[model samples]
Each structure stands twice: as structure tokens, then as C-alpha cells.
Target: MFSIFSLIFGLLSVVIGILATIFWIWMLIDCLKNEPSVGNDKIIWALVIVFLSYLGAILYYLVRRPERIKQTGQ
Candidate 1:
């Protein structure tokens, strides 16, 4: 009985950890590839995301990226 419970929780933890890792990697890549037209804040936030981990990624996308920077007129 205990073995079955452990297996289920362990599997769930692994899956969640993997998903978080993937999202972290994706955010790092997004930061690097963001255009100069997007401005310096983008790079700053990207560095923040890479250095700070998951919270940085969430903050970058949720608050900074869409709301802070304007699209280039050109």
C-alpha cells in the first residue's frame, strides 16, 4: 500500500519538475532571441529570468514583456 502511494507521488513530482524545467529553458531562449527593437528591458528581464529561475520567467512574461515594451513603429 505504501509503495503504491510513493510511486504515484514520485511520478507526479517528476512530471511537474520536467515541465518546470522545460518552461525555464524556453523562457531563457525567448529572452536571447528577443529583438533589439523590443528594447533593453527585454534583455534585462531575460537575464533576470535566467539568473532568477522560474519566478523570473513568470514575472517577465506576465508583467514586463507585454505591458512594458512598445512595438517598433518601423
Candidate 2:
């Protein structure tokens, strides 16, 4: 029988896994949609996200995401 703590940990692990998978997918799509001027090669970014998984996604978000320009209506 699983202990209470063990069950909680297991549940937490599953949740984390699901969240990570979602994050990875979102990052992959974002990378693909990013313009060339926004970063380096889109293919390379996608590969990195695939191979490194969650960590790669975090890295791309932190390091490679482009800055947004504010539109001033004249």
C-alpha cells in the first residue's frame, strides 16, 4: 500500500509531467511561429525544444523570445 506522502508525491509527479508536456508543445509552436529576425534558425530552436524538453522550452522563453513593440496610435 502506498503511504500518504508517497501518494501525494506520485500525484504531484504526474501533474508536473503533464504540465511539462504542455509547456514543451507550446514552446515548440511558438518557436516555429517566430520570425527569422526574432532569433536564429527556427529549425534549430524546434530541435532543441524536442531534445531538451522542458528545460529547452524554458531556455528559449528566457533567452530567445523577442521583444514586443508598442504601437502608438497617431
Candidate 3:
């Protein structure tokens, strides 16, 4: 029998996992669509996102993404 707290935590974990998967997919697609400009390397960034998963995606968003945006002026 599962306790209420345990059930809640389990549900939370599942939700978090789903959200993470979605974010990873979104990042992967974005990396694929955008060209490598300046500091960004498209293939390397895609691999990083694939291997590092959530952490890679976050890093790309925080670091490489802004650089690409700046380069494009959009």
C-alpha cells in the first residue's frame, strides 16, 4: 500500500519527467533548425543536448542561444 506522501511524490516525479522530456525535444529541434553562428556549433550542441539531457539544454538556452540571437539581431 502506498502512503499519500509517497503517491504524491511519485506523481510529481512523473510530471517532472514528462516536462523534462518535452523540454529536451524542444531544445533538440531548436538546435537543429538554427544555424551555427559565432560561438554556437550546431552539431556539437545537438550532441551535448542528447547526451547531457536536461543540463545540456539549460546550458544551451542560457549560453549559446543568446549568442545566436545576438548574431541574427532577432
Candidate 4:
């Protein structure tokens, strides 16, 4: 039960999990604070992040944040 491959994969999984958690929290905070409450945009993004978690965070980071920052100068 002590295979080297298992150990390596377990460690890798832990690291990835930690990183994903950090990114999630970071994105959540960024959205809450920096994302404008112009209408329902902020609420929708917050919901997306909360419900979708890491995948949501990745989506926001890749899809929306850049454009918002550019448009709003946040």
C-alpha cells in the first residue's frame, strides 16, 4: 500500500487542492470588492463563483475579470 507512485500523486493532489482553494478565495474576494454593483452583474458573478467553485473562478479569471478591469479601470 506504500507505492511511490501513490505517494507522489497524493502529494500532487494536495498541492493542487490547496492552490485551487487559494485561487477560489482570491477570486471571490476580488469579485466582491472590485466588481461593480451596477446591476445584477456583481450578484451573478458572486453566485457563479460560490456555486461553481474552482471552475467558476477559472472562468471568471479567464473570461470576465480582464474586460471589467479594462472598462472600469478597477
* Top lDDT model: 4
lDDT of 1 by residue, 1-74 (tens): 99999999999999999999898888777666663534576568777998889999887777755654465421
- The residue-by-residue lDDT of candidate 3 on 1-74, one tens digit each, is 56988999999999999999999999888888884644548888999999999999998888878888898753
Candidate 2: minimum summed lDDT over ten consecutive residues — where? 65-74
> lDDT per residue, candidate 4, 1-74, as tens digits?
67998999999999999999999999999999999889998999999999999989999999999999899998
User: Model 4, stretches more than 4 Å misplaced?
Assistant: none
Compared with the true structure, all predictions reach lDDT values of: 0.75, 0.75, 0.86, 0.94
When summed lDDT is taken over every stretch of 10 residues in candidate 4, the lowest stretch is 1-10
Evaluate model 3: give its TM-score. 0.85
Error of 2 at 63 (Å): 0.3
Which residue segments of model 3 deviate by more than 4 Å?
Answer: 37-40
Give the clashing residue pairs of candidate 4, or none.
Answer: none
lDDT of 2 by residue, 1-74 (tens): 56998999999999999998998888888777753543566778788888998899998878766431112110
lDDT of 3 at 58: 94
**Roughly what TM-score does model 2 have, to 2 decimal places?**
0.75
